[model samples]
Target: MKNISMKNVVMGSVLAIAAVTSLSANATPVCSGTVAGNGASFSAGTNFVKVAFTPKCSANVFLDGEETSPTVFRVGSASLKGKTKFGGSSVGGSVGNMGACTGAGGVCSGTDSAAAMTAASS
Candidate 1:
């Protein structure tokens, strides 16, 4: 009985350690601070890349000065993508007359340093 209990504890510890490590490794790009805006992540394949964002703003997000794919269309929360080697993807949010990608009125705004293309998972 004692041996079995010891084994169980060891196994549990290993699993816990693995879970923590995996979570840290798989952590996606995060955005935080005075703006209190959204978070973003990406999954990339050979032919295409998929990006998703959690909208915490009152407006839309823009990519490369354009309001289109890979950004929410005039709303909150969005998922989109682009082809491989999509180039540098600059991120910003538009909330009313809040300027270009500038977070205001309880919205968070900033540019993501993430690659336009990344690995299979963030």
Candidate 2:
């Protein structure tokens, strides 16, 4: 009976480890590339800020953004190929403005242009 209990514990541990490994394998890849013609515009109808940009990457990637705090905006996710565009909205105010922008996927960065309604990745 003791041996059976120990075996059950070992099997449970193995299953847990396998589950973690599977999750890591399916994790989304980061975005890496140069951003060009990146810009943002506010839509009064939807009360959300719309962002558009073209990332020059070797492979396709996913891009996402949200309002982190107040007027701050953060963009993240996998690498990109061809053209990519995403929108972000703020929860604090009626008018949404992208005060800052960022990127993910290894070493990635971005700049926010509130005046010109544009953003660029670096």
Candidate 3:
């Protein structure tokens, strides 16, 4: 009975390790994209690593950091600008990251609008 229990423990440990390894291997945060009826689209990375907006609109996407400069990604018709929340860490995250949009030349407003903007926040 003792030997059997030891074998069971070893098998359980191995299986647990394999499960963890497989999960980690496939663990990737997903990015987000938004498309408007006017043929505009917006996309941003999960960890604030990348941001893309459509129709050649200029945008700045970033994670909140004291010494880091906000990186700009130029998008097209629909522009997307995002800042990770005060305590948040991801770009497209709901709780921590905030996204705002505006139209070219300040015509449109909100994410639903077909505008572009640059966002900077502390």
Q: How high is each candidate's TM-score? A: 0.19, 0.21, 0.18
lDDT (CA) per prediction: 0.24, 0.26, 0.24
Q: In candidate 3, what are the lDDT values of residues 1-122, reduced to their tens digit?
A: 65344323322322322222211111221112233222123344442224343321122211111112233211111113321111211232212112323345432223322121112222
Winner by TM-score between candidate 3 and candidate 2: 2
lDDT of candidate 2 over 28-75, digit per residue (tens) = 122223343222322222112233223222223333333333234333
Q: What's the C-alpha lDDT at position 70 in model 1?
A: 33
TM-score of 2: 0.21
Candidates ranked by TM-score: 2, 1, 3
Pick the lDDT winner. 2
Per-residue CA lDDT of model 1 for 1-122, tens digit only, reads 65344323322322322222111122233322223344333333221123332323212221221123332111111112111111111223222121222223323222321232121111
Cα lDDT, model 3, residue 35: 32
**Candidate 1's error at 113, in angstroms?**
39
Relative to the true structure, candidate 1 reaches a TM of 0.19
